[model samples]
Target: MSGIELKQLSEKVFYLPGTVNAAIVLNEEREAILLDTGSDKDHGRRLKKACDNLGVKPVVIVNTHSHADHYGGNDYLTRNFDLPVYAPPLEAGIIQNPVLEPIYLFSGAKPLPELMSKWLLAKPSRVDHILEPGALELFGVALEIIDSSGHAHRHYSVKIADVLVAADAVFGINILQKYPLPFGQDIGGQIASAERMADVGAQVILPGHGEASEDIAGLVKANIAVFEKAAKTIVGACTGVAATTVLKRSCEILGITIKDLPRYYLNHCTVMAYLSYLRESGHVELALQDNELRWSAAGN
Candidate 1:
């Protein structure tokens, strides 16, 4: 919270920097619509303080996705204010049941304590609205919901006032450099979404974890490049190897070390996504080899 400040990006759009970026869009009535809260209650409290400092009332919260870092503060915000929480379909389910995140990551089994940390599990909050892709008007501000599902299932980006609140459709360059795989449920959809983002008629793009940029095309291109590189690496490693082996080999190639349970599961899920994308694209095929699931280049 030391260097965090509410910076205005447009006429009425402002953002607060934290472990994740949260945005505030002011409407005609001086009320604000929050675009994703920060990671937890403390972060929510800071956001509230920032809003109060700016003398705007946060009347609603539109969550871009169900990832803990994006919607973790929903409970806090709803508890203090009678706020309406909005989320996309599948993501709404997870946001209302925070445990589902770790459960899904653990393949529907009981997750270990290490995987149930606050970073992975947030307090569940009620979703008052289920958002759909298309035009939406909240608090007198018109917004177009662009389907950006890939990073998370049912993730949507909001375009208001020529600024796109691109939740996780595109990661910041620093984040992409750090985590080459960048946690996605559908690699193909993620790549397509990144391409779609390039065509978004927006002057500014605010990403979930990094600073907003006016160079939307540049960011989108970088994101696409990262996705392509990861897909190529995963496909190359899939030469008659077990899925786990492919993940391990990809990690080695990317210089990623699984230091913790969360990291391991995140990377594992991302690798599975890559496999799905490759299989769909007919570049790889799966087989049962001696009771172990194996993946190899197609037409083998």
Candidate 2:
């Protein structure tokens, strides 16, 4: 709480950041609608404490996406508040069985124990409501569920008044900031998602990983250029390139120097998944030529 800043966008919407951003919406009757819980088990406790400190009980929980950091506190919230949870309909299937997808082991700094990791996975659960883009009512405030799926393919950004919970669709490791995260399932879609949120024209853009920004539209525009260029580069160079070669080329193309993280971490491992997914999805093709593996994107 030392560096954390909790900003009230209005009586209905509050922006609180600690490790991640969470939103609190107040109903006319003073109940709360919570969005995107933090990254650990204690998040709900902290949330409840914050509520007690502020004097309101949260009665609803909305997960903008299914990532561990966003939904990790689901177990806690449901147990404590009997809140009805909601998610994008497309993702409810995965939510029903939230496995800590094998992909994260390669990206996270400290992986969960096998037993805990298995349990951390999403359980097949019921969503009280499934959302679609545009203005919708929740608690007392009017909310918007805008599709911003590039980060997770099923991610959504929650908007209340002038503030938008950009979710992972537009925040976290901005690859443009560094060696961009290998975590996305689709680079192209991720960039598109960023643009969609920006276009929503919010005054305060609350992202998933970093500080809130006012010029989110500009940020999205800039990163889209980066994404498009990277996609073109990957498509252009692929007959199949070595993993090291790809990483090196990626570093150069993204205008960032890449320091490799551990393979078990989700960051590095997701690179492998991205490539495999690209190949499997027919966005790219794979082959072994001259005893060196290479990749080629499908013709534009």
Candidate 3:
């Protein structure tokens, strides 16, 4: 952990920053509760070393969701220490059976080989506890779990003191710029969660990725804008077009290129979520003609 030092966020909170930010919160007894491990075992080992440097033992892990990058390090940490893993009810199932990620991404069919990479599949780890949205007490530290599902079904965000581990509920400004549409399994829920984060009352917010900031309101606004922009683009693309055609047109308009199956399917699933949201909102309609499903603006 030469360059990977645990940066302090508060009197009791520290985090190791990487592709995903893994937080370390110290209880009264100095036991650490990790919030979301990084993308793989190397991240887990580095986080452990960082903990050793800080003179604290990681006694528990709280995963915000089932995404591979967020929970990928759970197997390493669980194997090295007797840490109890806590995750939202639905997400825990996928955390234990990670293949479900690519399976669902491929529209419930057997995923192609390209979809089996570590970006989408992580080693299975045991989930010893299930988390619900509410107050939680662990290792003598008080935590508030907020239901922020939509990015992944049943994703939860954690609040410790004035610091909120927002998870993927709201992406950092850089993340928003990196992936215009981001990723959402439920676009409606995603938009609602982004709106809710503004009222969460946390002075400082730590995203699962990117830098922490005090501008919670600004972050929430940016996230909602991205969701709405994607929704508008998808809606415009649905002019009696097939799903693939809609995805292509939307990506082209947004300057997004899908050169691999992983990127393609991630965007495809997200676009499908947008369509579902628009259709449910009565902004769009779908029809089956000649065995080809077509989408168009409602009443058109």
In every candidate, how many clashes are there?
Answer: 0, 21, 0
Model 3 ranges with Cα > 4 A deviation: 1-4
After superposition, the stretches of candidate 2 with alpha carbons farther than 4 Å from their true spots are 1-5, 103-126, 172-179, 225-239, 242-265, 268-285, 288-293, 297-300
The superposed Cα distance between candidate 3 and the true structure at residue 275, in angstroms, equals 0.5
Candidate 2 lDDT over residue span 146-220, tens digit each: 888766768888888788888777654353564353356655567668777777768877777666777877767
All candidates' TM-scores? 0.97, 0.77, 0.98
Candidate 3 lDDT score relative to the true structure:
0.91
- Superposition-based RMSD of candidate 2 using all C-alpha atoms, in angstroms: 4.9
Per-residue CA lDDT of candidate 3, range 30-70, in tens? 68999999889999998888888877899999999999999
Best by TM-score: 3
On residues 109-137, what C-alpha lDDT tens digit does candidate 1 reach at each position?
99999999999999999999999999999
Q: What does candidate 3 score on TM?
A: 0.98
Write down the RMSD of candidate 3 (Cα, Å).
1.4
